[model samples]
Target: MNNENIIDIIYGNLGSMTATDQKVAHAVLTAPKDAVNYTISELAKVAQVSEASISRFCKNLDLTGFHQLKIQLAKVADDESSYYDEINIDDVQQALTNIKNNKVAEISNTLASFTTPTLKKIMALINHARILQIAAEGNTYPVVADAIYRFNQIGILAIGAESWSTSIGQTLNLITDDVLMIISNSGESKALLKQIDVAHKQGMQVIAITNRKDSPIALKADQHLRTSVRQYVLNSDYYFSRVAAITAIETLFLLLIAENRKRLSAIQNHENIISTDKI
Candidate 1:
């Protein structure tokens, strides 16, 4: 059983235990591995309860003696390698499902969290932008390119920062009419942060899309759209966060397009006229 199941078991048996036994229960719940390494007297002393409470805890878990219970817990520690191997497989599926759920939830959350003031800020920047640029590194770079497509189709002069030096140079020369939307998962990329800072100094609007709410990039952004991705095990991989990031960018693209439908229609009409004349 997992820590959650262990917690459930303790709570389920709560009514049967005395006040002192409850103290032991609380300690075990608070620090199970620590409790596993503690002796009966040591636990009772720490919990400010009696030794009998520790003995009762073992009984509560269906073990005959405290030593046997400790041995079982030790076995659990020993079996962790196999348990986690199976968990990785299960967690991959769980992470995938979580990404799907989180992607939908993020769209809803971002829409709900969005405000008129923020929209006006972004709209003003986009409306007058001479060259709207988006920069992202690693796994998130594709999202930036996709966003550029939507921006260009809607008649905005938008492009992706495909190279680091190019991104920095483009950002350095940005005027008051430029806009930069930077996407990063960890939000700690040095190059991206430097680009954002330079853009801000150069009078360009900077927007951020990231999973970490507390990241420096999010803090530095003129506007932030935060995304959340679930990590099943320890969050060492990038399965869920990438999906969340992609979905956020797509949602932003759709919303921006919807907001500028009149301009988009005018552009389409012009294109249609030119195509007909050519034919």
Candidate 2:
């Protein structure tokens, strides 16, 4: 099993965890190293729960028991340490090397997590949709804009809204043949969630590209593409770079081209038009 899945499993189910189970989850998430060293009894005490509660937590994560949980936690701890050790603040060369390595890992992890069926579903939605609208906020705006550019280059009727009001206005106009794609790292944007509700009510399909699979936006989307990247820091509150999200969008762009070979001609025509200074 991929040990990284432990983090996803814990975070994805956080909303459904009981108070006691949440204690166990918090203990593990906050101090995974310390949690790894603890025995079942030790963890039970640390989490202020009974051993039975600890076992139930393990079961919820699909682990056999406490022992398996510890093993996975240890793996997660080791991976995090490696990520930190690879970067050195004092050395520019080392920092660049670490940055390149992290980006490679981020892209690899994002692509590895995608299944063929999921890709097919995404391609189908994009290819069949009569209209494509993208919604994003803050740092994710450029990513969504780039997606709109790519789709438009391929002769797809894609557009992006820059503000909440515009998003709501566009969502209000959506039809059953339309698709709304929202890009968010946290996937908890209140405005996006509201737009998603409106889009659903209008019979439009929603697609989410986000880091958290169980985030509110992801949960509400008809389809979600998850991007797995290491968090920016030890604290869960920090948002990381958009490298993973961009990579996922670029991958989808490539798939869209592959799905319709005629898109290559359209892209070339677009490039030729730009090269001659023709708008």
Tens-place lDDT per residue, model 1, 1-279, is: 222133323433443456777677666644556767999898889888778877877776666777865655554343221121212345788856555564554444444445578766777777778999899987778877877866776778887777878888878777888899888876778999999889988988888877544567888988876664432334222243456667776665667777877767856865786697784
Worst 10 residues of 1 by lDDT: 78-87
Best-performing candidate as measured by TM-score: 2
What TM-score, to 2 decimals, does candidate 2 have?
0.77
* Colliding pairs, model 1: none
lDDT at position 188, candidate 2: 85
Compose the digit string of candidate 2's lDDT tens values, residues 120-197.
998899999999999999878888888899999998899887887987898898899999999987788899999999
lDDT of 2 at 137: 90
